[model samples]
Target: MTLPLPRQRRTLGRTGLQVSPIGLGCSGFWGHRRFAEGAAGRVLATALEQGVNLLDTGHNYSGFNAEPRLGRLLAPLLATCPREQLVISSKGGTLTGQAGLGGTEQRDFSPAAITASCEASLRNLRLEYLDIYQLHGIGEHQITDELLGTLQRLRERGLFRHLGINTHSRGTLDWLAANPTVFDVVLLDYNLLQQDRAAHVAQLHEAGMGVLAGTVLAQGHLLPYRPRLPALSDAWYLARAWLKPSSRRLMRSASKMRRAVASIASQAPAQTAFAYVLQHPGIAAGIVGTTRTESLLQILATDPCLLDAADRARLVAVFGDGRGSPSV
Candidate 1:
């Protein structure tokens, strides 16, 4: 049986679309080998039945297999729940043709490529129009007039309801902050371990743009259980101290911060991370890429309003004490 929808809904910027605080990142559907056939569909179904409204996917995920997999499952789900009840989002502009190790090929953000990417994504997703279409990992150098014009044309054609950019580059954030009138949403990486872009979330909100946070758990770094050790702890810690002092400090601080957050809320480390990102008033939603239905349920069960003022202050002291984050 399908579950009831959650109570909390935030407006996706000025689009007037009320989205759940937690969005399902569908990349794991076909992007990873560990996810077996029908597993992703099951998770997707659970997420929907439990009231997740936003589903985010990329065009080039799993060599373009992600959208097709999601489409196959979405077809039946849409029959039960109307398409308008869900916010379907997809991204483009990542060249999958030359996507191997140690290659000279880079992402193509040109107008022709962007248009073709969107058209192909629509076909793969088996959808009439995407709720939100984003430029995948767009950087400052890629924000050209041609690219903007192409996106505008796509919107004019009813290909997508809104346009957004998924980026963590400082230059791209600066450019977006300067030219805020172009897009409706911005997806970026913001977690307790990396708060550099935290300030930008407010900036985008002030400019009337939705801010969707990615890497909320630092890509699983904040997961509670991990391998204990294999005698490399001393060497690894020593190397970190010498090569990445800031990262070392952040790691040490994270351990203590997790305990503190758990003391306040009694949640897993990963859930605490989600609460941190979702607590930000400017944040519209926190995108979580889970491979299991249980994982999605854990996220769905989290209270977005868990973090109090003291919790926020302690978290800020951990990663915001004038220390630079290590490059990912």
Candidate 2:
């Protein structure tokens, strides 16, 4: 499928921020050392040129080096275009000081800690305020008056324009259902191999909150072609598959899709995989993580063909969509 390069932009909730259908996620990118500066520059340049405006990063991404790297690379680019051409976003609360998710992670959602993390991210990114600031993988029990109050204060102080959460907790989802207006956006894993959050995303959208879908290619598990990057290499995903129940479950689904996709369509499953999630009504952008310009180019070229019941069913059946996964 050949999508119009740089697909049309969508507004994030009511924030008045315009974002591309495909955005760059900075997780597993910009580690402190052993990453080539030239390689990252190429990817960032291509993305900005292609009109991908949203960049999602967490405070702990790449051992706390992602934001600083982005700051240096993106500063000149922002000057070339309008400063508002990019929608900068970052997450805090999980101060693991490591690149990829695993057992060594540490999480803190206290008022002072969350506040300090946001401030540090601003300094690292060298920005006045982020367009969106999310709580990195926060659980329901962590949501509280003190934490919410601190975030509210941060927004009022112009540290961040919006507050969002990256989560898969049922309890947090239920809380969002009750207080739909509290947060302005959500970052969640939404893709063909996993569709459990399909209905939840739609509900969030209907309530007027923006959605940024991550891991749209199942952590490169479903991509026909994947680039090599330290800390996010094949070994990393393999480790993820072993440690995470969801990853293990999706591995089974990816296997089925790999065998079936070639027979059904001319496009690679990676293309179809992205389209499957982009067509979901609520998503402001599909936040794809990549350090290679070629892979980013492939994502920029996705057309998101409208899917009928059978086409949808064929894809969804691989993972068995629960509660009728989001479809075109």
How does each model score on TM-score?
0.85, 0.88
Best by TM-score: 2
**Candidate 1 ranges beyond 4 A from true positions:** 1-3, 97-105, 227-265, 322-328
Output the lDDT of residue 189, model 1.
82
- Whole-model Cα lDDT of every candidate shown, in order: 0.77, 0.76
Error of 1 at 22 (Å): 0.1
Off by over 4 Å in 2: 1-5, 29-32, 99-104, 224-232, 240-246, 306-309, 321-328
Residue range with the least summed lDDT across 10 consecutive positions in model 2: 319-328
Please provide, for model 2 over 1-328, each residue's C-alpha lDDT reduced to its tens digit, 9 standing for 90 to 100.
1112354888888677888998887767434445677787788778877877788888888778888888888777555565666789999988777523444468889998999999999998888899999998788778898899999999999999988998756678777867888898888878776677888889998998898888788766675544545454555446756776556556655666655554457456667778889888888889887766877887788877744457877877766644222321
- 226 Cα displacement, candidate 1 (Å): 3.7
Model 1, residue 40: displacement in angstroms? Answer: 1.0
